[model samples]
Target: MALSVREQIADNSRIDILSAAARCFMDRGYAAASIDEVARSLGATKGRIYHHFPSKADLFAAVFRHGMDLNYEAVRPFIDLPGSALPRWRRMAMSHVLLMIDTKPFQRAVWIGVEMHLRGATTPEQRSVFNELIEYRHNYGMLFRNTLLQGREEGVFRFDDLSITNQLMFMTLNSPIFWYTPRVGETRSDVEGVAKKVVEYALGGLSKRREEGV
Candidate 1:
C-alpha cells in the first residue's frame, strides 16, 4: 500500500516533535520545558507539536516510555538466552553499559529521569511518567532476582536474601551511568573491560568456591 504525502509528512512531524521534546526535557527539565520550545527545536509550529502530543507532559511521558522500551529491547535477548546466569548477567551488563555510552538519546533520557527524581515532577502526568521509570527499574531488579535464584539452584552462587542481592546487583550494574565517561583515548574495548570488572565484583562473593578461582 502506498501512503499519501500528507500521511508521510504527519509521521515525520510526529517523530520530529518527539525527538525535540526529548532533547528539551533533558536540557530544560520537564517542568521548565514548553511546547513552543519543542516546536521551535523541530522547526515546526506549536500546532504540529500539539497535534502529536496533547500537552508537554504527555510528550515527556512518551519520551520516558520510549527510553525504557529501548533499554529493555537491548537487554532482552541476552537475559532470555539459555545459559548459566553468570555468563548471561555479564553479557547483559556489558551490553547495557555500552548502550548507555553509545546511545545519546538514552543517556539524555536517563539524565532527565535523575533530574525529575531530585526536583520532583510538577504534574500528574509527569509524576506518572517518573513512576513508570521506577517500575522499569523494578523490572530490571526482578530479572536480577531470577538470575540469582537460578545461579543458587545450580550451586554456582550463594546469597542470603534474593531481594537484597537483587538490589545490590542492580546498583552495581547501573553505576556506570553515574561514573562512566569516555576519555579522549578510551576505546570501546576499554568500556567493555570496565563493565566486566563490575560484573565480576558483583558476582564474586556469590560464586561457588571453584568458580571463584576462575
Candidate 2:
C-alpha cells in the first residue's frame, strides 16, 4: 500500500503537537497549560491543534495516553522472561527508573496527572481515560503479583499474604518517582544502581529464611 504525502504530513503534525503538548504540560502543569502555548511551542496554529484534537481536554488525554503507551511498551518485554521473580523485578525497576530519567516529558506529564487526579480533577472523558490508565498500570502490578506467586511456589519467597506482599513490592518499586532526581552530575547508571539496591532490599524481605539461619 502506497502512502500519500498529505497523510504523512497529518501524522507528523499530530505527533509534533502531542510532543509539544507533553513538554508544555510538563513545564506548566496541565491545569495551567493553554492550547495556544502548546501550538506556539510547536510553531503551529491553534487551528492545527483543533484539527487534530477537538478540545483542550482531548489533547491532554492524548498526551497522557501516549505516555502510558510508552511505559507499557518499555516494560512489556521483561514481564514474562524466564527468570526468578526477584531478577525480573530488578529489571523492571531499573527499566522504569531509567525511563523516568530519559523520558522527562512523559514522566513529568504522568506525575502532573497523578497530582491532578488526587485533587479531584475529574471530567467524564478524563475519568474514563484515567480509569483506563489505572487499569493499564495494573499490568505492572500483575507482574509483581505473579512473580510473588511463582517464587512462593518455588519455595524461594515466603510471604504470609500474596496480595499484601505484591502490593508492598509494587509500592517499593514505585518509590523512584518520589525520591529520584537527576542532578547535574547524576547519571543514568546511578539511577540504575539505586534501582538494583531497592530491588535487593525488597527481595531480601520476601525470600525465605534458610533453615540453618546465619
lDDT winner among the candidates? 2
TM-scores of all models?
A: 0.73, 0.76
Error of 1 at 94 (Å): 1.8
> What is candidate 1's lDDT per residue for 1-214, written digit by digit as tens?
8779999987777667767777787677656889999888877888877877887667776776666677787788877778787787777767766666555455576667756676765456567667777687568557656767888887778878877777677667666665776789988788778777877876776675674563
How much does each candidate deviate from the true structure in C-alpha RMSD? 3.9, 3.5
- Candidate 1: worst-modelled 10 consecutive residues by lDDT: 98-107
For each candidate, the alpha-carbon lDDT, in order, equals 0.72, 0.75
RMSD in angstroms, candidate 1? 3.9
Candidate 1 local lDDT, residue 83: 79
Badly placed stretches (over 4 Å) of model 1 are 1-16, 104-133, 185-187, 205-214
Q: What is the lDDT of residue 198 in candidate 2?
A: 73
